[model samples]
Target: MQTEEGMVQDMKVLVVDDEKLVRRGLISMMPWDRYGMKVIAEAMNGTKALECMAAEPADIVFTDLMMPEMSGFELMEQLKLQYPRTAVVVLSCHEEFAFAQQAIRRGAIDYVVKNDLETDVMDEVLERIAASVRSRADNRPEQQEASLHPLFYEGESPVRLHGIPGTEAQLMPHGDSAQQASAEVCQALWQGMRWLYEDESFEQLLTLTAELRLPQSQLKDMVFPVLLKSGYLLLSLEHSLRWISRLEQSRRWEEWREVLQEERSYLRNLLFREKHAAEVVQGILQAVVYMHGKEELDFSQNEVADVANMSRTYFSQSFKGVTGKVFQDYVKELRLYKARQLLLQSSKPIYSIAQQVGFKDEKYFSKMFQQQYGMLPSAYRNQNPLRVE
Candidate 1:
């Protein structure tokens, strides 16, 4: 243990990876002092890691799942029987998430994806693991809960959360998590943005998104901000916001993956629609993002024209040229789409649902709803009740 000014900061870390660069990156990249941890040892493989542990015990072990001498899984099994006090954190590739899950079942405390470890992102992860380790050492489970999932308001009452700090979430982020996303992840996200102005193929974007994809809990910090940068504002897109909200509420990483798969499919359809190369389409994409944010479909063609900084006639022609849809019709269809969601999720009277979804008259809403969804709102709701979860 190390102490200065009568404070104890004594968590020791052991880093193990087969690749020398990976070992060096994990060791060099960590801000161990901030987390009250010190790197006591480094190893090229699991066998050497165990030797280091036997000589000088560590509080945490950051290990890669695959190695030349002994695999991470085998090392974990040995650690379980040998050093139960030490916690394991799997350092992994995106494709190795399945292995990480198995490691978790075998007693890994957490995981940090190697490919996604931007400096700040890694720091956030370190903070979480540190808090967890601190909590375990102190024998304070309450501190663990308070540190990780800090209190958020629910209605009027302040639900007790042991002794939560000012910050929220178990993950480290004093601010927006998105801003804290790693450079690689952010670059992967911008690959999609590049599609707006470049001739980037839909398949290319798909490959990027697939590689960038991580469990929402793992990715919570970065997706929104990068999406905003790419002009896919969730705030204005009510349905998309709902999708994210539901994803956040999901209980399992598997659920997050499922939701993400659907989101990617939606992006494929929207971003690649009648793909064009001219810069005017970039403006059209921006204008579409800006106006789509308003769920009521309240903005006028002139407003969008102004937003696009083009004459009404030209913007109209270009918007269709880019989207392959008339502006008014697009807005109408989007509003109807939102209405369909409200129908299944809420039991509001058909007229009320119509008004909330931007219909001046219930009859007109029903007409549009039928045209878009093939049924009246109430009938649709009857046919498809609110999903159980």
Candidate 2:
């Protein structure tokens, strides 16, 4: 597809799978050029995939969920840390569908079930990825500038900065030369902190700080407060506050620098962990929604795990951790909840309603309903008869 400059940008793709036949089949079947893409490389597993990426970076990676040396999930995490711009799509078998969903939540753009792999599905996924890449490329400058704003102090209008465009001209901060210099240093340090949170390289942080003309002598003192205010430490900010005070009082600039670097590394790791946790929570919530909205109560933990792209064991544990119920119990509760709602709202007979909600035997359904609600389905329906208006 053509970029905004009207230049064609071929999407580079890397196909990864442990199975040789599957990899060969995908490479032969997919019309890469038709989708404005080219398979620049292929790998048998995640370890090989990383090696391939280092040699020839790809815009998109299609990887199998399970592979030797490194699993798809581990590769995804590594990619998120190293190549946040590249998009990932997972391929997995029907049994591992839940694991695929987890991959998507962890930053994979999409997933394809090997059992249901189709040309149309691949086409749709490719189209979506292309659109996303194009959109990001179009908005890159604006996004970069927006990300810079957090570095500014409160009420320090970012629009007025000469480096940033689109505002009425305003004079630079007017005051003592030293005071202005100090402010500039603080801003530089804040910008450095911003980069740290974004998982940027230390070299980029150094370049940005240098560009701001920050004095090296002031680096230690200037950076301390910015780290404290970053809010990344959350519950432990006070503890870090004490440590910062101690470092400053000790007047150990070299040690202070070391501590600051450590903190930045810590913050970067913390941000990634938090982001991963949020994704898992979101994936599980979506699974719960899917469970509640289904027409058939035939859903299994395996199916739910597939939807979340998590292993059944992991999904079960995570489901309990997030929702305070085991996977089976949660699904059973939802099915019964729906049964209750239908019992109270509709005139459908108990047997039909039971079957609709996935209960095969009416007697067993009645027993379950009675056990849950302390009354038979018919009795409950009679007591709360629907009002026809």
Candidate 3:
């Protein structure tokens, strides 16, 4: 059923067949609601289907073999490469076994003969396809859930262990033993990320965890995805770190060590369930650090907008939305915060601290600090007693 807001609880389907009568019958007769499928659009041929795909995203395609402009084979190839998320099902006559075989080989999920097109068959096909699509919905971390089905057999790496019992290894988690093993595997993944980026001691953990009886190869396979995902995460994180390097010079590397420690859980979660969100937040933090480190760079909202890869206007809005402060205000407050810390902690002159926080003149920095904190830099240092670290 479709809601008042036009949100239909149906798997979006694109039906493409050259024969008008067949296409119409399939679209009109199929119990789409029952199978949780919605015939969002119909195409007379493969060419038309491709055109529609660009405008309307479909969860699956039910296409005919013989078409005028483009054949089912061609369409299936395009769909497999381009819209991999959208599954394909070939629709040809029963005698066209060779065509159906070819379609299946080309990555069509299933094939249905035109003469043998029973409602039950279509219902079953749609149900299965809907299940596949729904499984990928962004609810939790994606990396942790590997399908138990045979389809993933080709994609998975061979399982091996250093001190395990069985020669033939299975990747599927079974009981409490398997659950504990999987947790250990996840911890290894976290360790590997730290090893690669933060230079954390990971080899010791790997050598010590051999008592888990996991196949060495299986553990390697599990660790592989985390390594690959962390590469991208590291690139985005490093991009932000570049900006931070300019903000403060004292124990700069140590500062990164501290910040990465704080954000490790967020990064690991990104490596597992929410990679893109992690990248965005990493970039944001990097921007903050960069602005602080480069206390005298004269950076502007537009520059930051460009760095964040957002439109100047949208960047401003997102900056406020995420950080709860306008971009300029956030930058100023950040700089002032750094300036205040320097004032109390270090014997660095007020002018030097002001310059270090990105202000050209000490007077400007002092005035901004006073307006923000209701006190001059010297006065703040005098009133607020520094806590010994």
Candidate 4:
């Protein structure tokens, strides 16, 4: 369909409502073409909506706040995890406004009151959603290389030993035994990494690694190749292998033991650090989700750190390292961003808006808002008024 500028635009939409009449009315009465959107699919419940999405993905989902089988909030949580790019617009009645607000806090772009459904309201919502979609599209890079290896993102190389045949073939006396030992060491190493990723205790990883059985004579030969295959730098692997060989040639069993012990310690420490880094990333993600889902702005770094099961000092350092912003700065940005959206979309009084977005004092909220946007909240609202009267 053509926009006011006469440029053709097409956006796929999915409409979901449990009420048969409401579903039919939205599909039939709304001028989807005029807004450059097509009601490509419809579902009576969140379950059905998910099925429809699997069959044919849509640009936007307009879903009811409450439904059988799966509630709108649950579906939205799933969508945020799985299809983060798909924008959701909640449909609610007057009584469900609170639920709608919760949905917005949880990443929904907007909401519409069913009782106030009209051509103009739908038009405004559609335009806003379309503009957001376009902005995201424009900002995203055009080309992205698909990963071919499972461990690629984990800093592991996809390369395997070239000369060694299958593990079964290499299991014969000298060749087979060494290959078998290598395979076992590799498996143990990967298992240790997995344990670290799951935040399993470092003691557990150390114990598991210690239990792995490999011939001491074959340990260097077996472990070196696996380390190389596991994406370790060639120079480092070569240096390690050379050190082990020199120890063996000199018959310095005591020194060899010391070196091997150091290697094991290093591996354990590496896995622990990797696990800690992963946990930090996960903690930050959870914090952002919590910030968005809550109505009150009273949460603190201590609380979030507790949720992450990390010390406040360490959590703060990791938060800054990963997000490039301190905890307070990041939270302030989120609060101000949400406040700005509320100012533009709702006619709620300044005090109410401040409270809704988690500000206890309106004056403080206005001061922070002005600091962020360089203008008073009221002036900003006046400049970018809601499309709907």
Candidate 5:
């Protein structure tokens, strides 16, 4: 987004999102090179984004709303004051339309729904956004409240599943009131939620719930409660339409059970075996996913935790519980793993490889490499050199 003189760089973009996948997806959604657009940088949160912009200002920023330490709103507010020329575009979930509206009022030039993005939809959005940037129609006020239409959505609204995060649970088919769970039954059901809220496996949770043998409608109602209590509500609601389809099609209890069984591995990966209960697990989930997506896991757990809006102690504990490994250990392992891959597959120098994977000291990287593989990086490359034809 660096300007040659005073004119803005057309479509020179920076993406900010806690989730690395979403950030990468937005960047790669179109072939920027072909369109004279460049992805300036990718930042995990607004704070890092500001630093990136200060070093090399981007013409436009595509940021998400619910980040940890620095939310998109805060970032935009800063942009309005510090970098007024830089166009701000919000990337949001459908349910966050109200927040996006507020962002528009503040100073965002435009917004796009993350949940509804398709290649074609993204093309139209990018064109519109780029045009606005080129024309310098900066942060124009909306004539009316921005409303979401089906054209901007790919599936049924998540609200249909449980009406946003903190509301009362809804029954699928209206179970009999008399048959509704009693205090004791509800308490017992709540007790069963341990299989979910705690870091228990999906199979274990399903096994416990299956034993209860409640009516299908009542049982269906239990899903949201379990997810709500587990801090998996937002994650689940993000994929609600998919699960709701299964719930609707499965007439029998067994069918419903089968649907859940299919999702076991995915759900299992999402849960930690020793859950540190908090209202929001998105921070933990985002941090883990963000780390995995990177070739160089350079940042500290504290940095990631801070960006995710969790206490360092809590983030460390929750990360260990969810991933079954300490954060530093996990990062070390990932770094070494990538270094090993690069050593074997890439012709880059050993020191270069080490630095690329985030080790500033080549000797330290070599020591870790030798410790991990029983040989130094150079030795490993010699043993397993890859020749590209």
Candidate 6:
């Protein structure tokens, strides 16, 4: 385990096993300290492991398959379903290949046999697992460059001022200047991510902030938090738009609408470029917003192609590629989402609600509703009548 004085400070690991001898052997054999990992806790059984996890969560788990209770598989299942952020690496002396395979299925990041334990293999697994962890944390540089990044404040444009291509940004803050840079970077990342709903270049805004000169150690800290905050901000914005649109005060709503509008405008600017995938996503979102609540609208492939100003074949391909769904599916999902809102908030009948959300036939609407919500529209309405306004 790494000591506090020289540790990377980011890597935290947990070792769980029934056999104390084996646990101590594994811990003593590995150069865990060199790898920047610290053994935060040890547990003799699955139940104890869970307690340890709740008390001090570790980034990685090394567990033995056989234990007095709560075997490795059960612990892995609990962790996978609950604290999915923690990666599991299972171990066992038993020559049962099925046990390892099952571990993989349960979302264990990797499985290492006790018999196969070697310095080289352990190193390889650790490196691969660490890389995977980092990748899942944020979009790659290329992805960030392609997305639209919006600045929230009305004053100086941070991207324009700091993104001069040659400037080296600090990853984290150390002194007063570095700390200020970190704050600025975080703010820019938050605002840029909001704009990313419309445009894709939001990463440049963060990069511009990160470019402030700071120590290498501080810089690493800055990157992960910025990425994390960006994701949180995006999720919050999405939830607000979907569930609490009217709950916002008028002043707050006006501010929200203005930010959304600026984001949309920034995306439109990106779309003119015609070459970026962000532009393609921007175009699709524009189409989605335009069709919202238009009962008379029918989103044909040809119409979408025309709206996006591309061939039907190319448009369909790029639309699915960028959004991870076919155009038809995307439209259907959007309509269902809106319909759910209307059903919960308005006193409209099922047929009227269907028509309001672009479904012409009540029968088709009911069928689609059943497919999405697993209940008939009438039953759904009866169970969840509109809230009194």
**TM per candidate:** 0.38, 0.39, 0.36, 0.35, 0.35, 0.35
Local distance difference test values of all predictions, in order: 0.62, 0.61, 0.57, 0.59, 0.61, 0.57
Stretches off by above 4 angstroms in model 6 are 1-200, 207-278, 292-299, 385-389
lDDT per residue as tens, model 3, 122-200: 6754555455445434222344334332322333333454446664434445445664765566566554444432223
lDDT of 1 at 312: 98
Candidate 1 C-alpha lDDT tens digits along 1-389? 33457577678899998889888877887788887788999998889999999999898999887576687888888898999878888876532223433554576766566776787676777777876566455543333333223222112122222134553323334344553344355456454454434445433443333333333334554454343333223212323433444444444444554665576556545644665445676678778777656656656789888888899998888777766678777777667756766765666788887877678899988988787555677766664313112
Give me the runs in candidate 5 sitting further than 4 Å from their true place: 1-10, 137-389
What is the model-wide C-alpha lDDT for candidate 3?
0.57
Poorly placed runs, candidate 4 (over 4 Å): 1-9, 95-97, 140-389
- Per-candidate Cα RMSD to the true structure, in Å, reads 19.6, 21.3, 23.5, 20.1, 18.3, 16.0
Candidate 6 weakest lDDT stretch, 10 residues = 241-250
Off by over 4 Å in 3: 1-8, 119-122, 135-389
Model 5 lDDT tens row, 1-389: 33557665546688999999888787877666655578979999989999999998888898987676787888998988888778888877532323433554565656566877877666666666665566453322232124221221222123221123553323223344432433235536443533333334445454444433354444545663343323222222323333433444444455666766665335554563555453345566667556645766567777788766889998788777775667777778767766866765678887888888889999999999788656787765663313111
lDDT of candidate model 5 versus the reference: 0.61
Model 5 misses residue 202 by how many Å? 57
**TM-score, candidate number 5:** 0.35
Using TM-score as the yardstick, the better of models 1 and 5 is 1
Candidate 2 lDDT score relative to the true structure:
0.61
Q: Candidate 1: which stretches are off by over 4 Å?
A: 1-7, 140-389
Per-residue accuracy of model 6 over 1-389 as CA lDDT, tens digit each: 23347544667888999889888988888777666677888899888999998999988889987676687878888987777767787776532323433554465655555766677777765665565445433323344323222222223233322435754332232446645755665655553343554334444443443234333223334432333332222211222221112111112223434544454454344434344566576566555445553554456778767777778888877766654567787678767656766765678887888887779999999999898767786665454312324
Model 4 CA RMSD to the hidden true structure, in angstroms: 20.1
